[model samples]
Target chain A: SAVISQKPSRDICQRGTSLTIQCQVDSQVTMMFWYRQQPGQSLTLIATANQGSEATYESGFVIDKFPISRPNLTFSTLTVSNMSPEDSSIYLCSAECSGNTIYFGEGSWLTVV
Target chain B: SQQGEEDPQALSIQEGENATMNCSYKTSINNLQWYRQNSGRGLVHLILIRSNEREKHSGRLRVTLDTSKKSSSLLITASRAADTASYFCAPFSSNTGKLIFGQGTTLQVKP
Candidate 1:
């Protein structure tokens, strides 16, 4: 299992502003991903962070809105662009380890006012 | 990716009791994982069971995977107040390599 750390664990932002959440893994991982949990709903896959390449976004998530960058195997960032009140959610970063077991970070909780 | 369906949207039990939750997936999976999330907090990986394995135990948590039925179950023996949280099940082995999370079962352990 890999240890994941996320920055800006909790933050409050104004509508229309953008917030970038950083994720750092203790060791190199084969796969990195971003997930969003809105209010009481279950977490949804936002994108798959590919090192040295463009991230693959999931349905209902656009790169323009939730841009992700993975400069290396151990680090990635997710930026919520043009945020709205509806964009308030807990953003989580995860890495897949051996045997397809994934570990999650503490998560970045963003509240858009 | 197939999403898992968790049985019993919510559950309440007394301390020292055993808590059980079931999850069913629509597709075959290489691994199944159970996660716990405290209120407004991050996800905690509880246990992971592979398709080839039938049952696994870690401390007070026991997880069983039934690949033939595409379902799994998590049982927590001797539940405590700290065990109160949201339990979610996710099945791995998707062609897309993305994890689909179930709505989760909210477990409340009253002390």
Candidate 2:
């Protein structure tokens, strides 16, 4: 099992500002992903944080808005740039471990003011 | 497109009662996974059932997958107030190598 931890558990930022959420895994993981959950909504995959390369983003999400950095197998970071009220949401970091089970970190709660 | 839509958008049940949530997908999948989130917090993986498997159990949680019907169900028996949360089903398609999430079922277990 992998223990994934995230930082900045809760924060309120001003519009136009950016916030970076950090994720650290206890063990090396092959796959790491970022997801967003807006108010009263389910999670939506933001991007796949790939180590040593650019992240793979899903449709409706772009690198310019959500830049991701996976420096190693155990650490990754996601930045929500040029934030807006629409960007206020819970950002989650997850890693697929134990073959089939995926573990998630206690998400970062960001509220844009 | 490996997402599953959850049924009964919201459910309200008393403590000790059983809560069942259903998910239906549009395409075939290799496996189906269930996750829970409390008060919009991070997700906790509850259980996973492979397409070939019919049923799986973990503690008070039971998951059943019916590939022929392209649907799955999650049953939480003897639920408690702590079990009040949103439940989601993620269908994994080997073709995409990822899981897509749909709007989840919000279960409110009243104490």
What's the TM-score of every candidate structure?
A: 0.98, 0.96
Measured on C-alpha atoms, candidate 2 has an lDDT of 0.91
DockQ of each: 0.88, 0.82
Worst 10 residues of 2 chain A by lDDT: A95-104
Question: After TM-score superposition, what is the CA distance of residue A13 in candidate 1 from its true location, in Å?
Answer: 0.7
Model 1 achieves a DockQ score of 0.88
Worst 10 residues of 1 chain A by lDDT: A94-103
TM-score for chain B of each model, two decimals: 0.97, 0.97
Classified by CAPRI criteria, candidate 1 counts as: high
- What's the true lDDT of residue B2 in model 1? 83
Q: Give Cα distance to truth, residue A47, candidate 2, Å.
A: 0.8
| Residues B12-109, model 1: lDDT tens digits | 99999999999999887878889999999888999989888999999999999988888899999999999999999999885757689989999999
